[model samples]
Target: MDAQQFLEEFGHIANAPGGVGKLRELILSLAFKGELCVPSNEISATLLDDIERQRLEFNGETRKQRLTRQSNTTTNLVGPYEIPKHWSWVSLSTVGHTWGQKKPEDSFVYIDVSSIDNKAGVLRQSPEVISASAAPSRARKVVKKGTLVYSTVRPYLLNIAIIDRDFDLEPIASTAFAIVHPWEGISGRYLYFYLRSPIFVRYVESVQIGMAYPAISDEKFYSGVVPLPPTEEQSRIVAKVDELMALCDKLEAQQQARRKLQNALRQSTLQAVASATSPHELQTTWACLADNFGRLFHEPEDVDDLVAELKNLAVRGLLSEASTTSPDLEAIKIDCAQMRARYIADGLIRRQKLVGMADCEETYPAHWAVTAFDEVAIVIGGVTKGRDLRGKQVMVCPYLSVANVQRGHFKLEGLKSIEIAADELAKYQVHEGDLLITEGGDWDKVGRTALWRGGVTNCLHQNHVFKARVPSKQLLNEWVELVFNSGVGRDYFAGASKQTTNLASINMTQLRSFALPIPPLIEQQRILSVLSELTKHCNEWCRQMERKQAMSTLLAGAVVSSLTGITIEQEEEPMKAPQTELVAPLRLGTTPDIKAQAPLATILARHHGEMSAKDLWQRFGGEIDAFYTQLKTEVAHGWILEPAPAEMREKLADSVSA
Candidate 1:
């Protein structure tokens, strides 16, 4: 329950994902509670008098008007938590003076929420100057040296800092901040630490109004309680905090350097296995990695490099030996021609232009035959929207876009439907065993392939995704997808696709010309079998790493909770929509959302407006992290509010978090 016990476990705690932040919160909490430093015989009462006298002399106001007026304004005021008897509980207004606001009359430097480096609680030091005529309306608050600027909007972001340097021009902050200039005898650094502590932030959360844009008004913020210490003890606590925080900085830097080293080693070792010239060397290199796997692979993300190397080895005819028999290219061409004739006769698909096949540079077993993608498969573009169909009969059908059609899977949730001419559906409707490949997007997303096995019936693809059907039974969709999604296919796409500012796209002609290495049906199945077995081990390794990470995180939380004397509150159950809508203004501790905000709820499973909404009475009372988690999830998926993926949308959430 003290610094000694916490420091003993610092190494283990810092190894966890978010341990350093928890350690910081604990340090601030203890410092404010009089546990971090030895107390002096001097009590805070003497310092309180010094602060009031200085403030009164500066403002020229009497005690009745300045100190006691609304200082205890609440009906029954009580401090949030007990402090040492030597310390006193005082409102922030008693310790700091509020400043006036004014619009910029001339060019000035503006500091907004974006100006803060939240982690360090310091400015980024990049000043942005605003013109007097072009100043934003929100830039109206004044800032001076030694003043603590704490953002009232999204207060949990910890956008709080003390101005320490002079600006050539007047510095104006956005109205979003509550500027607090400390009175004499109060250390601004100590006040800054207490303001960012968990207990203080929790109090802010409980008093803030509204759910969507929750913010603490300047009035409520100034009325919040602060644990005041004697001037001597304040200086001691600040010094100790700085010393311990410097140690934390060292731990954090060492941990990051270790992870960087591990990642680099994994990449080099995997590269050795991937670049092996023969099956013997591949086995030798892989054995070396397997021998040192425990030392190299410590995170679940490391498996990505391992899996990529496996794919490269598989396509090179190194994972499994090539069979004596070769695929019959003539027979495959004949089968494709017969299917094309039948489709032409039935008006199913268009007559694709036969194009010359391009050569692939990589060497492969002579037993494996090479063919262009169009020779064995029918590749076609999907339907384009915005066409005039005013007089035509149309039907709404679920379709796949670049978002739904992922590299090796589909994101079926929140499926969208579009109206298409009923008769035109035949050409666009995708069936089972079709390979869906993205036409264009980012450099990494171009030519990404996924196989469709009928997750949603009558599903069509949009123009951004290409649908390739292998009508011939000789070529399996599974095999084609494997080759198309492997390193070979990705390399071709990266080289051939038209690229601009990290975005790239490929036309049907480019897709049809892709060189595919074809093996006999039996050999294809054998290679897949080998890949399946090896990837299974890799998958299990990744799962083990995740479980280990979870255990480390749990242990760190438990130790922190025990030492800090904090009861980790259970997360609130998700909010449910009422059977009937209510009229506003709403009451405390009741449903807050009407109907339009219900889309936030729809993001969850089978739930409409299901996001957690606290009744006004219990505004974020139990746990601060629960509220922050809700905000983090919302921000990660906020792009979905556009209901369109113009570009990135928490794509990392699926890839890395998984």
Candidate 2:
């Protein structure tokens, strides 16, 4: 069917998420049914004759022999009606020798599914030397130069490759394989496509065992029936599919580029807004962004970036530029001194060693007091645990675990319920407006703090949380939150932290010694109000971005389905055409199979004389892909980045030139 007609019939699939995947399945089913192409009179006549001859030959034998031959072909084909006219039902094994090779020895050249491109059905390479034990067995089948190999273990792996070079063959595959060598007029490429169809994959999955390691058996492999076309038509179908797949690849690339550009534009808009330094500047920035709201935001990530920028701006004192007058330092200091004296007299708080500093310069806002964090608030360590409690039955007390602490904030998702005696609840009960700081974690998060807004009435904290119960009458909780999240707090936390493996942590003493910039109570409230309003705005923008992202994802899937969708007619009809003739065998390259290589600098010069490291790595493909994947995972696990060599710049420059 033509593209336009196909779309008219199955257009709904194009608009749904994962619709393209369904379309691909439909196309494959139709292709096998011979409905993808129109049939000619001559081809139809010849196909009918071939079917009749086969039937006659079967009937000529004794009833027992005939039954056995039919069973060998397709046991479930109860009658000739099972196969359409001008169509023949035969096992794929009829075209190739099954279990053709036996292992000759312990070592020989070998190929694994990983070596093949699952997408293009081409063999990809690695440079690492394979262990002698891993070499294919001596008796493994020798695929002829034009034969195709499909990985049977993961039917969906779609690892099909056409053999070109005649290597001294070894028992190449694990028992999980169904190798196909086309007979005189058939095309291996066409057969490869047929095997990749979702219908075939579903057939494989139907019999596969084990959820974790699903696999199809060898017996099942040789039993499944396949649709075959004339040799010439097989070539035509193969060529058409290849051209269309390439077009799909180009479309995917374009979509990815568009998404990237959209993200960049969103980021730039956020940056521009954040650069505003005054109320007028901020108003101008807001106006520009408000005008282009639809254009600037498009995904959840963009909104997240904007939220981060808002947090940064809030801490930097840019969010409240309009009503943020100079803070009154003397008044704040007097108030803090009074509160500390009262706490000491009541013995409600401890007297900790505080950090002292010289008076600040004029640039230090006249209305803001600079003092050690201890003077403004008390910092205490969490209760010590005496033993491992993994399997113990404890009370279900709402408790904060180490994971609950974030950078100057708390995330309550996956909050754990701990076993604490009802009598001991008084000691750990969390109150509204009380700040909880992470006492031990990565250095950046060690001193992170968040105020509890009392989401739960009786939630208590765990031993890992250091509570800072501040007086709401004197201090603004939002102001404290902003300070703790700011860069100044980050630097102090980093400096006081002690490193162990991938983690860095701080003790209570570090928190007490940390300096803080305190503003007058009124000024703090003003700052808090302005920051709260602006952050809410940023949050709203983020939500819109997330919605857009969902839409984009849906759209992309729809487009993909449109390109690969199968039509209604193809599913019901089977076409007869001449078989495909192979004029040339597929080319397969041979290279060492090492998985890891020297640093990019060393490899760049050898591969591309003067190319950038990025360009050279892309050319290499496999090792670089593995390296980056590993690197990103390590980083996520909190490993620090090791410094790259200084010579990398020169190497990268040379690669760029090349």
Candidate 3:
């Protein structure tokens, strides 16, 4: 199929567990059956017979090269028409004389099996070796200039490299490997891809003896069956696979680049949107952003950035510019100044001994007054006497803690009850429309405030969270809350905070030092109304996004299930592309639950596919039998996941793989 057609048919398949894997398995199945590419007409019975004769004669004389006889490593005869007319299957050992020794003296480059691609037919560099003392002393395996070296330990790594350079240097390689030097007429690259094809790995993994680190010996490596095509056809298939794989790499890189650019564009647009000063400007910004909203904001971070901008815009009075048309802003400022003077004169409040407001050359709207927050609102410390009353279920009284307050409002869930001395209840009780702020914490979290809309009739807050009660007659609670939570409050809080060892706090003086923009009560309410509406919309947007992400996760999992053939129900037809277990011990890959790990195999047999021994080992691999013994002790004392029979004596096989 063409690239476009393949994508359309199996685009859902990711380079994950099930999706593309199913397609990969199918490709192998077809390739082994001689269906992946067209067969050559040159392959015939006479040519195959000649190759067999050479193979029989070589096997008769070569006792040292004889493969270990294994029931599972038996070879099957291939039909004449099943293979191309000119193609022949021969044992891999037929092409090369053994260069079975390793020598370190020569300038031969050393290669490790780990350096090769286990999944592709390409040899990669071996890990860098630093120890000269560790160099091999045996005569180096002399592979011809065009030889192919296969890492037998992990054949799936597909590390096949063509020996192109005429170097007398002998590279040190693993003993568990077979190097092949292709005969004349057969291209090394063609054989490389064929080795990478699923036929090789599947044959190794299927009849592999033992339960852990299953492997195939050299006998099975050479005797394994492969459908070899004519020399020319082999070259064609190799070229095609190489070209397609390269294109896939390019496509992946392009997609990654596009995603990065989209994220950058979203951030830029969000910044512009926040900086808009007027309704018309905001409208234009919004329109531009909306035009590419679908493409620009697919991720959660983008939505979070948008929310922050929304908060900034709300605090800056851009949420409802029309509300500033009224002239009450100046009137309220004058009233607050008078109130501050009155309080200072009457000794009811503190004087302006704290930091003064910074100078801003640009004047605010004519309808708004730039006044100190303390001048317009009363900032009081909450009660701090609930040390011994944690985690206790008490009567449902309205109580706001630092945890109770969220971004814009209070949360009632998991509310802690407190014993507010009956006589002092009236003094500390919180009412509706009170602004709650954190008194101390990280500098950024210090002034984080939210408006309490009176979820309960009589609630109180702890001393850690400050209470800023707006003068109902002058300032609106919502507007004051927004200012304190916005960039304005953030800047003020950051400046006034005193940072100590691991803690930053804003005292009562700092809270009162904030220079707030005091709008008329009505205009403040209007801005708050606009903010509330937009915030609700943003929240709904967040919910939708979360749902979409959840769906994507599920779909990715479903795609995995489709490829692994783990399911018995053949509910769907084929269409695809690309793109564990083991609990032998509590090692790097093992689980920690010893009691659970102890009976994993028996449990696995009973649970079917619900869970596997591999899962148990993964969960409790570290201590193994010790963990089990401890788990059994815990079970005796009443714990979970322990096998029912505490004395069940099932011996564990040494299935651990290094």
Summarize candidate 2's per-residue lDDT along 1-658 as a digit string, tens digits.
3556556645445333344444555556556656556542234335434544655553433453344334557423332122235545555654444325555454544665666777667766531233455554432654556777777665666767776555543435544555666655567777777778754665677777777667776556656656655656666667767766665556556656876888888778777877776658877987887888777665545566666667656655566533345545445556666766676676545564555542322133444566666666655445445535565555556777678877556788877676655555555777777778876675555767788878875677666778775543556766777777665566667667888887887776677666666665666666677767867877777765554444444334333333333211111122221122212111111221221112232233344324443443343232333435533443343331322331222223545659
Q: Each model's C-alpha lDDT?
A: 0.77, 0.56, 0.58
Q: Which one wins by TM-score: 1 or 2?
A: 1
Runs of candidate 2 exceeding 4 Å displacement: 1-72, 75-97, 100-104, 109-121, 127-171, 176-186, 202-225, 321-351, 356-372, 383-399, 406-431, 438-450, 453-466, 482-658
Question: Ranking under TM-score, best-scoring first?
Answer: 1, 2, 3
User: What is the TM-score of candidate 1?
Assistant: 0.83
Give the clashing pairs for model 1. Answer: 588-616, 589-615, 589-616, 589-617, 590-615, 601-609, 601-610
| Window of ten residues with lowest summed lDDT in model 3 | 572-581
Largest lDDT belongs to which candidate? 1
Residue range 107-171, candidate 3, lDDT tens digits: 54666665565554455544444244655553245555677777666455456676655544455
- Relative to the true structure, candidate 1 has a C-alpha RMSD (angstroms) of 12.5
| C-alpha RMSD by candidate, in order | 12.5, 20.9, 17.2
Which parts of model 1 are misplaced by more than 4 Å?
1-8, 60-69, 73-78, 570-658
Model 1 lDDT tens row, 465-565: 99988876767778888787788888988888998997999889888888888888888888888998999999999977875775566556556656555
